[model samples]
Target chain A: MREKTTEPLVRIRGVHKSFGSLEVLKGIDLDVDQGEVCVLLGRSGSGKSTLLRCINHLEGLNDGEIHVGGERIGYERRRDHLLPMTSRQAARQRQNIGMVFQRFNLFAHRTVLENVMEAPIYVAKRPRKEVKREALELLERVGLADKPAAYPAMLSGGQQQRVAIARALAMHPALMLFDEPTSALDPELVGEVLTVIQDLARSGMTMIVVTHEISFAREVADTAVFMDGGLVVEKGPPSEILSDPSDPRTRTFLSRVLKETA
Target chain B: MASATADPIGESSLPIRKRPKLVQWALIAVLGLVVAAGAFSVVNNENFGWPIVFEYFTSPRILSGLVRTLHLTALSMAIGIVLGVILALMHMSRNRFVQSIAWAYIWFFRGTPVFVQLLFWGSISALYPKLILGLPFGGPAWLEMSANDLITPYIAAVLGLGLNEAAYMAEIVRAGIKSVDRGQSEAATALGMPDGLTTRRVVLPQAMRVIIPPTGNQLIGMLKTSSLVAVLAYPELLYSAQLIYAVNYQTIPLLITASLWYLLITSVLSVGQYYLERHFGRSEARSSLEAR
Candidate 1:
C-alpha cells in the first residue's frame, strides 16, 4: 500500500472526556497520517466508542485537544486555555469529519436521495442542481441507484447503512469515524456494509472505525488500536497488534474476542 | 435454524383450520338486542319529538348557526395548532429562559378552565378598557381602541378557545417530539448540520408520526369546546338552539338538534383526520405491501 502523505490527518493529544464524575477517556493520544485507516478494537466500556464520539464532537472534552487535518475540533486554543467553540463553529468542523453509526441512523422521513443531498445543499450552500447530480452518483456508488425515492424504513439494514455512508461522503470529509458501524446488523447484512468500508479504505479515505469485527479490521486497517479501561493499551501496525501484543491486557482481550467469534 | 424447520416429510398432511369462536356469536346477539331496543324507543317515545327534529333539521336560522359553529371550530383550531407548534419548539429550547417562558405560558393557559377563559375575555374591558398603541407611558399615541370594541363576542370566544387549546396542543406536540429517537439528532449532527436546520429538517418531521394522532384529537376537542362560547352570547349552534327553545319551551328537542349537528361535523373531521394520520405514518408504513 502506498502512503499518501507524511503529515498526520488526525491528531489526538492527551484528550480526556468525562460524563459527570465518571472519567471515560483518560489522557488518550493517537495519530493517523493522511489516507490511513485506523481500526479501534476494544471490549465494551473500554472508551473506544467514547473516544470515537469525542472526535465527532458529540461529546465535549474535559481536557486536551483533537485536531483533524491540522485544525482543532469543537474547541479553540486561546493563549493558555481551550475554550469550547460556538455550535455553528463546532458544526463547521464536522464538514470534514464523516461518521457512520452502529444502527444506521438515516432520517426515516426523507427519501434516500434527500438524505444524501440535505447537508450539502443546506449546510454547504451548494447549488441544488449540482448537489442532486452528485448525490445520485453517490447513491450509485453505494449501489442504491434504483432506490433513491425509497424511505429509510423500506430499506434493509445494510442498504440503510450504505446510504448513511453516501450521506457523509457528500460533504467530502477529511476524516471519517465509524462507531461499531455493523454491530447492530444481522450477520448476513454485516458483510455488505463492511465491503463498502473496505473499498473506501483501499481508495485512501482516512477513517477511524470502532468495531468488534477482528477479521474486517485485519483485512482493512493499516493500524490496529486496542483500548481498555479508558486507555490505549497498544497501537501498532495490524500485523503486530492483531496477532501478537506486548501488553498483557491486549493479548487477553484479543484472544477472548477471537475465541468468541470462532 | 432454517434447516431444522424445513419439511422432511409430508408436513401439510394434518392441517387443522381455525374453528369458530363463541365470543363472536355473543357479540352479535348483544349488539342486535341493543339496536332493536333503541329503535323501539325512538319510534314509541313522544317527548323525543322526532317530527319536531325533522322540521327544524334544515331550518334557516339553525343551519346558519351550524355554519357559524363550523367556522369557529375551523378558525380557532387553525390558530391554536400553529401556536402549539411554536410553543412545542420553545419548550424544547436548550436555553432555560426560553423553556421556562414556554412552560409558564402553557401552565397559565392550561391550568384554567376554558369557560372561565371565555368569560374573562368577554369582560376584558372591566380590567383594561383602553389599549393605546404607542410607545411606553407619556409617549405620543399613534392609535387607541377601547377594549370593548376589540373584545367582541366572536373574538373573545376565539381568543379564549384558541389560546387555551394552544397550551394542550403544546403538550401533545412535546410528547411527540420526545417519542422520536435521540440518535436522529446525533446523526444529523454527524452530517455537519447546525442545530436549527437539524431540528427543522430532521427531528420535527420524524416527530410527526407521534404528533399527528394527538393533534387530531385536539382538533376534535376544539370543535366540542367551541360550544363553551354559547355562554358568551355568541350565535353558535348551541346558542341558536337555546334561543329557539326559550320561545317554544321545547329545550330537549332543540338540544337534540344541536347534538346531531355536532356529531355530523365531528364525523366528517374524523374521516379527514384519519387520512391525515395515514399520510404522516406512510413513510415508515408499507402501505401497498401491508394491504395485500
Candidate 2:
C-alpha cells in the first residue's frame, strides 16, 4: 500500500437531497483522502446509500455540491449561473467514479468478459484488443478467469458481485463506491465478496463503502463514519469509532451489531 | 410435518387421483365429435361432392386467385413489418416531439375502423384526381400520376392494412422495450456507449425476448385480416370463391374450399411461430438460471 497523502480526493459539502419534500440527506459535509478506505455505517433508510449515489449523481441532489478529484460533479457554470450538467455530461463525469450496487446490477445479457470490456471500449474509447487484454487480467484478478464466457445469471450471487467489482475496476476509475455490496447476497456468500473488497483496499484503491459488515469495516477501513437519521453522528479512526465512540447513537448501533453477530 | 403423518396416504399419492385421465379423455371425445360432425356434413350433403371440392381447388380461376391471395398476404406482411418496426422505434423515443408524433400516429390509426380506412383510400381518387410528385412550392414536376390510374383497389387495400397494422405493432414494441430493466440503460451509459449503439447492441437484443412472440401473433392476424381486401374486389381467394359460388350456386362447397386453404396456411404459420418462440425461450431460460 502507498503512503497516505494529505490532500483529499473527494470533498462533499452541504449536501442535501430530497425526494418530493422528504429529505434523505441533510447538510452532509465529508472529506475522503486519496487512497483511503472510508466505511459509511448506518441502519436501513439512514441515507448512507443515498449519499454514495449522490456522489455519482445517480440520484440528483437538491442542494449542495460534490467534488471528485477537485472537479465539481453534476453542475457546470454557464454565464455566471451554475446549472446541472446535461445527462450526457453527467454520465461522462460518472466514468471517473465506479459503483457496485447492492443487488449486483450486472448486465444480464453480457458474458463476464464482455461486461468488463464494455465501458473501456465504448466509454473510454480504448482499442478492442487492449480492452480485452485488460478485461481478461481483471477477470483473473477476481479469481473468475474460468468464468469469462459465463453470463451473470450462471454465477452465484457472490461471484456476480465480484464480476461487478472487476467490471467497475476495468474502467480505471479514480474512486470506487460500494453501496452495501454484500447485503443482497446469501449469508455464506457475503464473505467471498468482502474478501475481494478487502483485497482492493489492501492494494490501496480509494473506496467509499456503505455496509453493515462491522468486522470488515473495523478491519479494512481507515475511517469509519456512523450515520443516524440522515446525519453523521460520529466519524473518526475505525478503532476509536468502533470501540470508543463518544455519541450514544454510535454506541447503540455498535452494541446492536455486536449482539447480532454473537 | 405432523399433518403429513396424520394423512399418510395423501391425496397426491392416491391411485384414483394420480392423473386427470378422465379430463384428457373428455377433451379427446369432444375433438372427435366435432371432426365427425364436419365429416358427416360433407359426406351427406347432395351438393358436397369430394370430386367437386378437388375440382374447384384445382380450377384455373381458383388457382390464380390462390396465387393472388398469397401475393397480397406476402406484400402486406412485408410492408407491415418494416413500417411496424419504425413505428415501434418512434414510440420508444425519449424526445417529447418524437414520442408525441408516434402517439398521434397510433391513436389515429387504431381509433379508426380498418374497413373505413380501406374504403376511404379506395375512393381517394374522388378527392385528389391528380397525384403531384414535385416540390410543394414551385418546383417542376418530376412525374405525375392520376389517382384513378395509379391508385388501384389492390394498392389501396394494401396501404390501408399495412398502415393500420403498424399502429398495433408499435404498442407491442413499446411493451417489449419497457420489459427490460432500467439498469440495462444505466450500465450502457456507464460504459460510455452512445445512445444508439447501446440501444442496438444491449437494449434491443434483450427486448427481442418480449417482442418476437407478439409479432408472431400479429402475423397470424394479418393472414386472416387480408380477407377484408375482398370488399374492394381484389380477386383474392375468398372473393374468387364468392364469385364462383354466386354463379354455380354452390356456396357451402366453395366456402369449405377457401376455409381449408386458410387453415392450411395458418397451420404452417403456427408451426413457425412455435419454433421461433421456443428458440427465444431457451435463451431467456438460460439467463434466468444464471441470475439465480
What 10-residue stretch in candidate 1 chain B is worst by lDDT? B283-292
- Deviation (Å) of A59 in candidate 1: 1.1
Cα lDDT tens digits, model 1, B31-56, are 99999999999878999987887777
lDDT of 1 by residue, A147-206 (tens): 999888778889999999999999999899999999998899999999999989988899
DockQ of each: 0.53, 0.36
In the predicted model 1, the residue pairs found to clash are none
Candidate 2 docking quality: incorrect, acceptable, medium or high:
acceptable
lDDT of 2 by residue, B11-58 (tens): 586545465598889999999999999989968877775666777977
**DockQ of prediction 2:** 0.36
User: What value does the interface RMSD of model 1 take?
Assistant: 2.1
